[model samples]
Every structure is written in structure tokens, then in C-alpha cells.
Target: MAFVGMDPERIRKVAEQLRQSSHQLTMVNETVQRLINQATQAWEGQDTLDFSDAWTGQHKLTLQQCSEQLEQMSTDAIEQIAQQEKTSGITPGGPGSALKPGDVIPGTTIPMDGLTPDKLNAMSPEDREKTLEAMTPAQRAAYLASLTPEQAAGLLNGMSPEQSAGVLAMMTPAARVAALSAMPTEDRRKALEEMPEAMRDEVYGAMDREVLAQTIGHDVTLAKTESTLSVEAEAVGFKIEAMGQGEMVVNADGSSTVKLHGEFGGGRTFGSDEKGASVTAGLEAEREYQFASPEDAEKFIADLKHAATSVSIDNPNPIDDVWKVLDSGHHVDRFGGYLQAEGHAELGEFGEIAGGGRIDVLATPSEDKLEASLKLHYDASANAGDFAKFSSGGEVEVKGELEHGQLSKIELKASTNGAFGAELEGKSSSGALLTTTHEVVQGSNIGQGGEVKMTLSADNPGFSQVKEALQNGDVGKATELAYKYSDVSYRQTVNTVLADDEHSVKLGAFGVDVAKAGYHFESKAEVSTLIMEKPAGSTHYYDISGGSR
Candidate 1:
């Protein structure tokens, strides 16, 4: 009898295959049981006892359970075929009629032939499992192919641990990766939890490298730094504070990224201690290392672990390459490879001084050297306060070269023109108030002779010594050598346009101060320093040796 909306012949074939599989499983289980029983008679130690327990507790049990389920499934499939044949002889639309196109099975909305993945997915877990169990392999594959990756993951989540393992085992590598990658981390963890150790190991080993990294997630906050700059002079004061927060994350493909966010704000006050006018400005910047290579990731993780450990005097292990991980590479991505920064200053009676700058960096490797270029542009202005008022704009270009993964040379060119000024107030020896102000009016040019350039070649004698010390984990020796032959210099010429007895006093400073005075004040300085420390509790001394001009 011909069946409607059904393939009775295919169903019979699949049932026969399942019956054969069940029989094969039964034979394998019997053989394993017999071999284990025979082995136990001759061996009677802990090792043999462990082997016996494993076979009986997990392997044998799993085999028996699977055999029973397959046998039951084959019987059900055969009965369905028989019922279809019996109903085929009845009249169409009668109680005993075969299921027609679009007709659902009793107590379910699942159609016999036109079943969609959406309908299958909508069924309860038990119903879905039963329906899939009854389908031929070709029918099952067709439906599975139509499911989205997330839907496939959902099916895995709904299955028991053994069933989930079986499903994953049956999928191709690509499909398996997609399904597991789509699953939530916790859900995937749960799926791996209840499986036997061997099966769990197989599942883990089969995962793609990138997928495994994502499944075992790692995001760590590496460091945080804050700084405050405070300048105090008679009748004038200002304070600037900055904080930077950074995080490092290992990417799926073994790359690493360090994200940084920094914020700064400050205010300047002038006049008497009780009453004064104030101007304030705030700014924020963001930076990222888009793709530091895998080696750098390992280096950072190693250094972090080293820093957190305590060492004994007799077994000291110093960390090398502490601040040198991501410096040598072309690490920035194309789209967002620029530093983004912006800020505004509120000038008391005047309007506001507002502007920002963008800095773009590009690096490329050629032969044995890596070269990097940087471009910067900034503009800020206000039509008021002498200290705040300004109409200024400028651009800077810098290039650096590295040899053997170490910095060897640098060059800079900058052009700037604008009206900018500064104000200074003080008290005279006889208690007289004194004031000095310098301003470059609109259209005037600064940084016109302000080009400052520096270079350090690997030919320097101390360079190799420093490298060797670091490689040997002698951080103290490395620091000493780095500073001994360091090529650093500074030059300053401050010609007071209008100086008096009161303004002659020094400007107590925090950072280095360089002055070249004229209509415009130009400052140029290049500096590098390294400090070494002795063992703890012993007298600490700095082995500093460098010349400055």
C-alpha cells in the first residue's frame, strides 16, 4: 500500500540500521564484560581494582543504556511503519486514514512532512528529542542544517549531558565550533561538567584555538596611575590633577590589547588669598594597543606574576623587559589608530578657551629595523584673560627608528603660530606689589625656531651592556649601564625683557625647566635617566653617571 506524506520504505531502512547498531553495541558490551571478569581473576591489586571500577561504573553502564535506548527506538520505528501500512488501506479522511500533507501527529502540532526548524525548535525538550530520535539520518541532517547556530546551541543546552556529547560528536568540525561558540560561557561549562573524563577531554581537545580562548575568558585590569601638578607663587596659584586607568585583554587569536583612559582638570587662581579670580579646564583622552603579538601577551602575563611574588635573598628572580613589551611593533588597527582628546577651559570674565587635538601614529617594519611616524594637530583660543586668552594653532611631526627591537634614533619637526601669553605677580622686598606679563599678540608666530631633535645609535658603548644585563635578569646592573653612557642634554637662555628686583626670584619648579627668551619664549630639553636600588634593609644608593649640557 502506498503511503501519503511519508516514506515507509525509508523508515524501515533506518529502523533496520538502528537494530543492527543495537546488536553491535550488545556484542561489544558482552565482550568487554567477559574480558574484565577474566582479568579480575588473575589481578588483585589497587591498579586492577581501579580498572574494574571504571569499566563497571561508567563504560559498561553507558554501553548498556545506549543499547537499550537504540533497541527501543528501533521497535518504535517499526511499529510506526506497521500502523502506516494498516491505515493506508482505509478511506481518505476516515478515522484510520494515513496522515496527509500538512496534517499534524495526534496531540502535537508537528506536521508529518512539511516540518520546519522553527516548529521543531518550538517543541518541549522531551518531544523534540523523541521526534529527532524517530527521524532517519538524512531527515535529521536536513533539519539540523536549517537551524541557526544559536538554535543549535539551544538544542545542545536542552539535551542531557550524554546526549549533548553525542550530538557534538556527530557534527563536523566547523559546525561544532559554531555551535559551541554560540553557546553562553556558563552553559557551555555546564555541558562539559557531567561528561566522563575521557569524553570531556575529547570535547576540549576538539575545540578551535580561538574558540577555546573565548570559552575560557580572561580580562584583567593591569595598572592605574595618578599625578598631580601644583604650582604656588606669591599671589598666584594653580593645581592640575590627572588620573589614568588601563586594562589588558587577551584576544581570541592570541593577540593582546591594552586600553587606557585618562582624565585631567585644573584651575588657576590669582589675587589675594581671600578673594581671587579662577580659570578651570578639564580634558580626557583614550588610547588602545590594538594588536600586540602573542609574545607580548606572554611577556606581560609573566611579568605580572613575577611582580606579585615575594623572593628570598638567596633566590632572587628579577623581571626583565618590565616596561618594554609593546614598543617595537606596529600594533594599531587602521580605523581607530589615533589618539582622541578634547577639553574646554572656563575663563572668569572672559568667554571660554576650548579646543583639542588628534594624534595619529603609524609604524612599519623593514628588514632589521622598525620605523614609526607620528602626526599631531592642536588649536585653542579665547579673546580675554592674559593667561587664558589665545589664538593658537600648530602641527607636529615625529619619526623614530628601532634596530634589533630597541630604540635607536628619533627626529621631530614642529610649526606653530599664534597669540599666547603668561602672567606673573609677586611682592617686592619693601612689600611693593610687582607684576610681569609676556604676550604674543594675534598673528604672531611661536615655535618658528623651536625645532628640537635628538638621536641615540645602537653603536653607543653602553647599549649592548644594558641589553645583556637585562637578558641575564640583573635589573640593577642594567639600570646602571643604561645611565652610564646615556646621551642626554639640555640648553636654556632666559633673557628677561623687563626684570626688576621683585621678579628676580626663582620660579620653584617640579619638572625640568628650559627657557630661550625673546619676543617668544622657547624651551628645549632631552632627558633620559635610570635609577638602581640595593637589596632591601641595606643602605640604598643610586648608581647614576650621566653628562647634561
Candidate 2:
């Protein structure tokens, strides 16, 4: 029973042969069943073994020879079956036949190959544009979202400002900011400036202050220098020292002297000494003495004596002859020259100046008259204020009349070739009537087109007579009295009535109204009986009894 093991050489040879022959032997049913059982064990906290102990050695030998042999065998078997069906002319599923090129197989599907080159070439430009426009921003975003960083940049390069802003506005804040950061500086700045305030602030907040300052400072410095002043002045002058409040001390030739204050025309005065001479000027005029020797005082006295009598009287009129020649021709027989041998002229023309060499005719009386006549025709369309002007040569003329100072009837005319004229009529401060009818025509063209006539008449009704007549209830007398005092061609009627223990007077009129409408008047005997009524017809009927008498 304990027989000797086989010889070493024979045993080694037999082991090698058995390992080589392992591929030919199929696994035993029991061993196969064991592996199946182990693999099916629920994979719960245990390692799986595919071969039992009986087949371990042989399985190792076979697996060592080819690890992926089972997978290759399965693929080979499928390929062989396909080839066999094709050669036998039978479909794989139905009769084991393979599909031929361009054949449509029953119960088999094929995907549409990605867009064909021919189909893409056939698409019209309009169709492409419409397709792009029809795409929702979110859809487009998804397409862009899938791109690599490089592809996204290249795609964005073709977009316009409005297009970019719209696309970026739809992006998330973080993504938009990242995209802006990657842009060039100028592009980034333009994009940031165009963005909404909130977005711009967010992006600017993320920038470095130093970089921002440098960028903005360039523009600010450029703007500042563009408007800078570049002109230059050449001279820098000297100043003089004031000896006192008003006098200045002049220094020259190694000596000083006080000069009188001559900066202003009427010379300024400083305090005076007992003799009433200015101390500063007096000291400067006096000769100084140094107690060095008798010779020094003697020399100073000599200099003072020489200065006292050094005044010289030169020609009083160096240009006397030249001026005499000018004076002779000053009275030349011309319209504008000196009126006398002295350089003076009496301006006789309406538009000339008397004293000045240059005469301004525009500001003269004649010019004023011309302007007045033109303004009268043009500006008379509206109720404007009076126009008047003071000529340069002391002339005053009435361009128009003042409404507040209007005379009822009077016209003033200018005297011909005269300095003064007379007013036809005017009102005095005491309400007395003044009239003058002597017409003096200053202008030759007067009354050429038509007679310019004016008249003055009474404006106030005789209040004394109306008051007396109304108190007596004499309506007829009051009517006659009111008509006599009124200016317009109108007849007035007065009526008195008693109502509610109060007396009321009613005044009515026809013809020549104050305005375009006829006149009306009302009065209450007592203040208590008066009532205010609304204004009517752009005119008024006053019940003045309620007001102070």
C-alpha cells in the first residue's frame, strides 16, 4: 500500500504532460456545480472561487496559457455564424443570412448619420438665419456651455456689442465675470461701461484698485492737459519803498531824496510841521552836515547855495508854431470843424456832437427821431410803454406818450429849425385844464400824409350835481346832469327806487362807451344795502356806495 512514489524523472515528465493536456478535459459536473454555487453565494462578506480543489491545479495551468481565451472564443463563434449565414443566403434571425450593402433589413434599425455634407451645403442663408433667430437663448447657451474655453472665445469674437451684452446678461454672474476677466483691457472696459449699473459695480469691485487708478488716471490727465493755459508773459518789474504813508523815497547817485506822492492826480498829503511844510520833503531839501571838519560844512553850504538857484526857465511853448498852423486850419469850411479859432465846435447838425473831435451820429437826435418813427408803426400794435431817448448832444424828444399821463385832447408839435417847441395842451397837478394852440412845425414833412390832430376833454362827471340830485330823488334832473358831464355822445338816465327800507339809484346809458360796451352804474343809499356783483361783458358797473366816500 505504501508503494514507492514514481521515479523523479518520470514524475516530472508526467506532471508536465498532465498540465499540457488540461485544456482537453471538461470540468466535472460536481466541480462545475460547486463553482456555480460559490459564485451565486450573495457576494456578502466573502471572496468567490470559480474552481473547486479538484480542478484548481488544472485550471491554473489552462488560465496561465490564455487569460482572455473565453472572450475571444465567444467573438469568434459569432463571426463564424454570421459568415456561414451570408454564404448560405439566409438572414441571421430568420434563416441565418447577413445583410447586404444598401439592403433594408426587417426588424433592424439604423441611425440617421450625422448631418451630411451635401445637406449642409444645400441650406439657404435665409434658412440658416431664421434657424439661429428661432433658437432660444437658453438653447444657444447650452450649445456654448458644451464648448471648450478656446472654442467659446472664437465664437464670441464675431458678436456685436448689443449681441454680446444680451448674451452675457443671460449668463450667470460668476460665469459672466469670468468671461469678462479673460477679455482684453479695452474690450473689458467698454463692456463694463455698457453693462447695467449693478453688474458694472460688481465687476469693478472685483478689480484691483491700483490697476483701475492707473487706467482712469490716463484719461483724466489727458482731459486736464487738453484745456491747460500755455501763454507766457515776459517782464517782472520793480517796486519802490514808501518813505511815509503817501510819499516815496527815491535813491540814486549814492544819495536819497523824498518825492511828493504823485501816484494819484490830486496829490496825497501827510502830517505837516509847525511851519506847515511837509517834514519828509523838507528834510530832503535841507543840506546835511557831518562834524568831520570846518571844510565839510563850508562845502555843504556851497552845494546848497548852488541847488537853490539852479532852477531854469526853458521855452514856455516849444511846439507853439506847430500848434498855430493846426489852429489856422481848425476853422476849415466843412460840415464838421471847430466853430471858433479855439479847438471848440458848436454842433448845429441834428446828429453831430459839439466838443469831441469824433462825432457819433447814431446816438444823436436825428437818429433817435428815425428810430422812434419806425418803432411807432411796428410797436403800436400792442399797448406798450412810452419810448423816449436822450441824444448825445443834450436833446430830449417824446417818441410816444405815457398812458398814465394821457391828455384828453392835445398835440405838441416841434418848432422848425428851433431848439424848443410848445405843447398844445396838458394837465396841471391841481386838475386845472391848460391849452396852447400855436402849432410850430419842426419837421417839414408834417401833415403830408394826413392831419395828425389831438384834443383834450373832461373825464370826470360833476359829482356835486349828481350827488345833490340823487339825494332829492329827482331822477330826471340827475339824468340830465350826468349826460352833460359825460364825454361820449351818450344820453344817460337815472332811476331811484325804495326797497327793504333802502334807497337805490340805477344809472343807464347809450352810445360812445368807455370801452366797446355801453356804460352802467348802481348805488346803494346805505353801506348795509350794497352787494357785490360779478364783472360782466369785460366791463364793470360799480356800486361805489359800499366803499369809502
Q: Residues 21-45, candidate 2, lDDT per residue (tens digit)?
A: 3323323433565675676576543
lDDT of 1 at 538: 16
Span of 10 residues, lowest total lDDT, candidate 1: 492-501
What clash count does candidate 2 reach? 11
The local distance difference test score of model 1 is 0.48
Q: Which structure among the candidates has the greatest lDDT? A: 1
In candidate 2, residue 150 scores what lDDT? 39
- Per-residue CA lDDT of candidate 1, range 492-518, in tens? 111111211122232222321111111
RMSD of 2: 49.2
Structural similarity to truth (TM-score) of each candidate: 0.24, 0.18
lDDT of each: 0.48, 0.29
